[model samples]
Target chain A: MSTLISLIVSGCATGAIYALVAIGFTLLWQTSQTINFAQGEFVMLPAFFMLAGMNMGMPFWLAILVGTAISVAILGAAFKRALVDPMLRHGALPLAIATMALSIMMKEGVKEFYGAEAQPFPSLIPAIDLHFLGATISTQSLGLLAVGVAAVLALQYLLNSTSVGRQMQATAQNPNVARILGIPVERMVMYSFIINAILVSVASVLVTPLYLAKFSSGETLGLAAFIAAIVGGFNQVRGAILGGILLGITDNLAATYISTQYRSAVPLALLIAVILFRPQGLLGTAEERTV
Target chain B: MSITRKVSRLAVLTLAAGFMAAPVLAQPIHLEDVAELSGGGATVGTNFKNGADLAIAEINAKGGILGHKIEITHADSQSNPGVARALVQKALDNNPYVLLGPGYSGSVKVTESLAAKAGIANIMGGEAAELTQTGNEYVFRTSFGQQSTMPKVARYIAEEIKAKTVAVVWVNNDFGKGGRDVINAEFAKRGIKVVADLSTEAGQVDFAADVLKVKNAAPDAVFVYLNEDESARALKELKRQGVTVPLIGETTLTGQKVIDLAGGAAEGALAHVGLTTDAPIPAVQEFRKNFAAKYNYVPDHNGIKGYLAIYVIKAVTEKMGKVDPANFAKTLHGMTIRAKDEPGILMDVTYDEHGDIDRQGFLVEVKDGKQVVKTILPKMVP
Candidate 1:
């Protein structure tokens, strides 16, 4: 049916954004064995920064690139000084708290600078619809899906083929062994942070055009990403994508067939059900603990 | 004896001078704005603050209330009900003469009772119908309640738009649910059958499925009572699905954010709002210009409602001098504040004991990303 096709297209568009943010979560968790609560804030910073550039009369593409670059640079530096250094010296708790504080600071800072208006991002796609297979979909939706898939594919390739990818996997699997083998564990960790920042920023750019760019958007997106991460298996890249798409589809279908008031609740309910049934998640591997 | 008498006379003169200066030593009239300044509803709160600030500045520029300069104290509610209560209490402790608001209806409802107990008059701008019916004497709203506008909105869609079958989609929250109930009731009264009555959660980002159901219903029109963000997303998604039925709803659709988020897709979407800046009233026009100049943005109903609330206070204060909390209850009942050249989105506001406004509603259509007036419904004074 036309309704089904449209729902699928919207689901994919929304899922793509979730997948992008979820990949950042998975990458950081895999490399550092710690979650970066500030991941969503990284996404928001670029979007807001892009807004600032646009407000200053810069072109959209220029603004996006500048915003992405600034976010990556700041996040990279902050992770090195605040997260990596502190965790290496003390423990992971401090790093977690540091990221949380950074998230709060970034959220408030953006609000102060941006004046809390839900400004619209410039649409890259034309306001026209394409009818394919009995379903109508906007150019924005198609563009988001394409961009999301490409980012994931590009990330997958980088992690699989490149020397840096091998080093990252080596560091994640056995940091002590990799460090002994001269894999530059610290550098790998820092690279992971940079990549995390870049991935989140890319997601921000893609999603901002669809949703109104507001200060609190990070919170909602962060929650969705976290959910997607859990659903996909925390450290698995492909799992995250699968989880995001599933969540998006389920959300849309539930809103249509069931009660619309319970639309947001569907994902949480499914997450609970999934965790209870499959403790390791859809793609998560079981880990053995040392005595 | 003569020297002692002269010293006594000088002491008497100094005492007289000190007594005269005491009246001039009065502190400025402080107004406290307790609203969500941070978190989810910060945008709405900021709009409220901007409007209140404009009015306060203008009033102070012309020499503040009763010749005392106006001072404003703001507390961020953070969109939490508990925090809202704490903020209102904090504002009261700061010794403000009047309380402006906690903007959200749920928050306002919580603070209304507290304000009543404290004998502090609240100049509310929230439009929840239940807020006025709580029988809180000190609570007053300048904007018409959702109940007041429901019948008019329904009638406009049914009669003017000539839409027979209509679908309803609203948020589960009090604001949306209440509006939905009123609209449904009005439709029932007019013997119109609602094809689909759907409810969605607040802050929902995806509405494809919800739109699909309405599309399946094949309604001539759809009514949505959703927040600006959700409404924008829903509108965009609906358009993406090719569901092009005439959409109508509450003032939430009038927000600039909705238009911005939906872009060109929002064109032709009709909404029932109270007034617009283009109203041919000099005072409203001046207010609009002044507000736009100060904030560098067009004032929406959120701002206009707050501005009008202050003007209402000014009107009542001018007529009744130094407002007595005890008499405040009676003074507000059936009170008529004429718009009088004020370009309010709603021309004139009249309130009864229940704090509901008896004002006309304006049906506006989003044309070229702006809210253009389609038709103005005559005042339905209750």
Candidate 2:
């Protein structure tokens, strides 16, 4: 049916967005065991920065470049040095709590500086439609899907096939072993943070078209990414993608067939079911702990 | 000179000076604006304040209402009910003659009782039907209530568009919930079958499935009752799915802001609105220009609400020949102020005893990212 096709097509597109944010969360958790609680804020801040740049008379592309440049410095080195490095000694829980504080600060900071009007996109993607089986899909949604998947694929290539990828994996598996093998563990961890920042900036751009630049958008995205990370195991690249697609599809299908009020309930129930039945996520591997 | 004579003369001088020097009549008429400034309802509250400010500036420049300058103080409600209560209580202590706003319906619902108890008129921007239903005589609305507009919408669907079946998609909030209840009641009265009834959350991002449901149900028309941004998102989704059925809603659907946000998705979306800046009338066009000049952005319905409320205060107090806080509410009830009598009201309006407003409304469709008025509905009262 056309309804089924529309549900799947749109679901995959939305899933692609959630997957992008979920993978960024996975990378931080894997590389340094650092939980960046302010992931949502990181996602929201770049759009405002781009807005600021445009307001300052920069072209749209230049504004994005400016936003990326600032995000690279602030979200990467400054974030690790200020919040993660000093607090990693305390434990992951404290770092998470700290990120929670950072989240509130960034949320308020954005509101105080930029007024709460929903900033629309600069018509980056042409408004055109592609139809199939009596189901219509916009070129914008398809573009977002393509960009999201391509970003994931490119990240996968860097992680699985490059020397830096091997070193990063070594650091994630065992920092002491990586250090013994003459790989700079700290530097690999920094690379992961930098990559995390870049990924989030990309997400902010993709989401702004459909979602608009909003202050509370981060909170919703932060929650969605967390849900996707748990549903897909934190360990596998494709697992995050699978989890995002399932989440998006289930959300749409549930709203279609079930009560719309209960749309969110079904995904949360799936999360609980996943936790109870498969402790290690749908695609995540269980660790063998040695006493 | 006699000591008694000197003392009596000094006392007489003191009494005369006291009588002539201070009457407190020259003091400014105080009005407090308790609004949502920093939370989800910021856009609504901020625009309301800006509109209020413009009216105050205009009135003050022209020597004010009743020759006493109207001064307003703005308090941020933070979009929370509890915070709004505290701020209303604080404003009451200052003893304002009028309370201007808390544009959000929920905030207005909580704070209206406080002003009602204080016997001060609470002129507000909330359009929730239940707000005036609570028998609060002190509460006055600057916008259209659902009870006033929904029947007209149902009639339009039943008569003009001649739709037999309808699909209702509404936000699950106080305002949207209230609208849904009224429109459903109206639909039932008209024998229109509701094929699909969908409830969406306040900040829901995607409406793909919801739109699909509407498409699959093959309703003759769809009603989208949602908040501003959510309405745009829904419009976008509805466009993406290529749903061809006529889209109908209240002012929430075809506002200037929604048209801009939804872009071309808003074309042909019809709505009946009590106040719109896009009306071809010169008065409203002048107001739109002034508001944009002041705020650097086009004002929404909330701005119109706040602007008219201040003019209402001026009209009433001037009619009474004095600022009587106790009699302000009684005077506004069942009062008709014509547009020719007071140009600041922007349109002729009549107030019922229950504090609901009836004014000229527009049935418009979004054309080229603007509302083009298809028809003008006359006021309920002649």
TM-score values for chain B across all models = 0.90, 0.92
Local distance difference test values of all predictions, in order: 0.78, 0.87
Please tell me how candidate 2 rates in CAPRI terms: medium
- DockQ for every prediction shown: 0.72, 0.66
Predicted structure with the largest TM-score when compared to the true one: 1
Backbone clashes in model 1, listed as residue pairs: B275-B345, B284-B343
A-chain TM-score of every model: 0.92, 0.96
For model 2 chain B, the run of ten residues with the poorest summed lDDT: B18-27
Q: What shift in Å separates residue B325 of candidate 1 from its native position after superposition?
A: 4.1
Best-matching candidate per lDDT: 2
- Tens-place lDDT digits, model 1, residues A1-291: 777877787787788778888888888777766677777787878888888888898998999888888887887656676666767556567777777888898888988888777778776776578888877676777777777677768877888889998889889888999999989988888898888878877778777777668777788788888888888888777777888888888888887767676778899998998788875668877554100
How many clashes in each candidate? 2, 0
Stretches > 4 Å off in candidate 2:
A173-181, A287-291, B1-28, B38-40, B63-94
- Model 1 earns a TM-score of 0.94
- The CA lDDT at A132 in model 1 is 82
